[model samples]
Target: MSWGIEIYEKGMPIKITGRSFIFDQIAVTQNGSKTYNNIPKGRSLAAYIVARNRGSYFTVKVENNKISWNSLRGSQSINGIIMVLIK
Candidate 1:
């Protein structure tokens, strides 16, 4: 069994811990940014890159509710898994 954290909201239990209170996966666009408004119950944001195309690098940015991925060093294309964790 795994352990996490929760809080009571008006006598109801609300899960707010473990593996990032909330997690969202978004696809990378060759160029541009995407906005996500479903804010999770947490105080931090974490992101990871899972590259699909060999020898491709990207610069990822998370600002407010926006996530942007751009090919770096003239990479022809950008393809990968953007793991977003709100915790």
Candidate 2:
């Protein structure tokens, strides 16, 4: 908090940290999109990064109360993903 950006939640300070989760070990049909629910609410920004992959690509985004990862190139099956929440 000495330099750069600082975050707060309900008047409490927040750390710029991330959480990671893994994708199911199965086939995701080509050009398909999957939604992950029960994401934490009330944050300034929510973003994601691909952790690992097998043979597909992804375009990840956070919307409303869920996160969606679309197999933009083909059948997307990733090893894991990191969800970063910024307050």
Candidate 3:
């Protein structure tokens, strides 16, 4: 199994409900009320992006996307399992 992240397109509410499993433990950038998560090795930052601003829609540029992470580290059992629920 590869330690990585996943991205999805679903209703905005679902992202907030499942923010834990989606984000890593290190934020690389922060701007006012918005904080961007660090791009982890083998992990994409898409899921974390949506997880930040829950219940809101935003344009995510894959070439230059942002993320936000939680500073909680543990054993690498599961790195990414982001699920976007459809309404």
Candidate 4:
């Protein structure tokens, strides 16, 4: 398995490629409440939010070979690490 860190802006798409099996761990920061969509395809081996405030939240999503980050509130920042597995 291989891993990497990715930084993205709200509504941006990040591409991840490698072995056949892959996954991601994402942390996000937003300026307001938000909802995460399209998380990993598996059983969510694990997940959590490290931090949050009254006006901010976090979310993550993974689909196919790409991962897209979004904030329902709009205009937010996101950072996270994706772990890819090959089998």
- Which one wins on lDDT? 1
Q: 1-87 in candidate 2: lDDT tens per residue?
A: 233434453466544433322323324333334454544464433544424356546666666544456766555444445444544
Candidate 4: list runs displaced more than 4 Å.
1-54, 77-87
Cα lDDT of model 1 overall?
0.67
lDDT of 4 at 48: 32
Superposed on all Cα atoms, the candidates' RMSDs to the truth, in angstroms, are 10.1, 9.5, 13.4, 10.9
- Candidate 2 has a TM-score of 0.42
TM-score per candidate: 0.64, 0.42, 0.23, 0.29
For candidate 1, lDDT tens digit of each residue in 31-85? 6677777775455565556444676778778887777778885747777777666
State the lDDT at 86 in candidate 2.
Answer: 41
Candidate 3, 7-85: lDDT as tens digits: 4445434333333344333322222122344544454443334343332333223332443233233322223222212
TM-score head-to-head 3 vs 4, winner = 4
Candidate 1 ranges beyond 4 A from true positions: 1-22
Candidate 1 TM-score versus the reference: 0.64
lDDT of 4 by residue, 1-87 (tens): 676533334546343334233434444443322233554455332223433455554454544444444555566654433333322
TM-score of 3: 0.23
Clashes of 2: 0
lDDT-superior candidate, 1 or 4: 1
The TM-score of predicted model 4 comes to 0.29
- Pull out the clashing pairs in model 4: none
